[model samples]
Target: MRSTGMRARSVPHDSRPVHARPRETEYRPRHPLDLARVVLPQRHGAGDPTMAAANGVIWRASRTPDGPATLALRAGAGGHVRAAAWGPGAEWALDQLPALCGADDDPTGFDAGAHPLVAEAHRRHPDLRIGRTDLVFDALVSAIIEQKVTGMQAFGAWRRIVAWYGERAPGPTPKPMFAPPTIEGWRRVPSWAWHRAGLEPPQSRTIVEAARRGDAIVRAAASAPDADGRERIFTSLRGVGVWTSAETRIRAFGDPDAVSVGDYHLAHHVGFVLTGSRVDDDGMLELLAPWAGQRQRVIRLLYASGIQEPRRGPRMHPEDHRDR
Candidate 1:
């Protein structure tokens, strides 16, 4: 592995204090891999406490199964991904590098040639791949915060919560960052803090509830036989609908077929791109049915194609509920 001389300070969260040190690893993918595309999507926003992409390097902080970790990944010569990690979970994070960088994703049956638009997108970004973090609870918490809110609203709340409750990420990062809160940490966040973070009752309540059942949810998500089975497990919980479940699955498992069926703009965006008309959820599903097993890939391609729905109205105004 190429050396960057990066080091980390381990934060003691377990009974035994982790020796403060840095761990490094490298991975070479067989196919082309767009480091930015695979990693940037995992970040909730530019200000996300747990993720950042800058200067051709991607930094991420997370609560892994083993413990908390901070990871930095950069693309090196010949499609190699160089990863350096810090904190107690550094080894675990290093072990997860391949999956996080899309090693497990296979786009074999996708027929980009079937659609001109898709073909164009595929040509433009042949290296694009869906990446799985395998951090189901983290994805679940972020998805819940995003429910019925604008991206800005959700991102702001996520950043605040992380800053307030999360631990400092152990690394020589460019910016001060924090690992996302542990399951117990999330559950312990006071209701007032959620209010201050701009999280409304429904979203906050759902997150706390989910955190309460975090272990079971994680197990079900990881052990599900198929995407549908996983969806069923997620939707069985309160406040987790198809949209939320799909979003979580997309990040947690790199599931190609999980479409955000009830998204505010996704259906219309798909319709405009595919047929130059606005479409409802049913219509979008119909249009995307041709690519049944790779529906999400189709959406990704459409998004990457730069074909957007024409604006006919002003954007939705953001709401502030801190005083309500």
Candidate 2:
């Protein structure tokens, strides 16, 4: 029911407090429109909060009107926000609403005509949309946090950073919203803090070094011709290998072809999914040879197929360097 009533609400994503914003007040499209649908591949480590089924397509939050800390986003044409959900940092979330919907995927390079996997996946699940994420900031932080550590270790570190430095989400739901640490914040993290985050010296040093030169790296990426070029420039830094660079690119530019070649888990997952056998990096590459330019897309499809890795051992435990 579309309402022309006055109401107030907070916004989502941003950590700041909420204010007021004028919205459609009802769930009516500005124009008659149908739902926009697209197919997506299931894969490990490709989670985006916007795509999370629990959040739904229409996100509502309250804050200010112009760059409000909170906002409501409806999926489809003439996307009209309904009501205000209030909070802080709503503007940041709203600012990224379009990117959250995966608006930047270049159809020319990734269309089904060239990549059969994408075509097949689309055929299988017509509602999946392949959207490109804005990776510029998150990629750098994730890459730094992930340097030379187990997944559990890295995730723990990332959580700590967010909890300490991030703000509350401005949505109706009180979610822990985070602002990716600024370049200044990155430089200020002490050595002891890294140790407490369960990061070893190598990973810590790499991040610090990267942080010191972060501006240059960002500039390089901004000026590059494509994601591949950005990866190449990022890799030129010390301690950044093929795996690290590729992993970062996956988030930053949403490079569809950026297959994580050197990851500890990816090759094994690919092997198990594709060949029903565990394989090394070389084996994984060989198996994916058929997909060539769309290697990442193939990996995404295999993952979306809902295949799981057969476990033969115990999981890694979380270690807190803070205790030491």
Best-performing candidate as measured by lDDT: 1
Q: lDDT tens string, model 1, 242-320?
A: 8889999999999999998777778889999999999988999999988999999989899988877778889876442
Worst 10 residues of 1 by lDDT: 6-15
Give each model a TM-score: 0.91, 0.70
For all candidates in order, the CA lDDT equals: 0.86, 0.54
* Model 2 segments more than 4 A misplaced: 1-95, 107-122, 127-130, 168-173, 316-324
Please report the TM-score between candidate 2 and the true structure: 0.70
Stretches off by above 4 angstroms in model 1 are 1-20, 318-324
lDDT of 1 at 309: 74
For candidate 1, the per-residue lDDT at 90 reads: 93
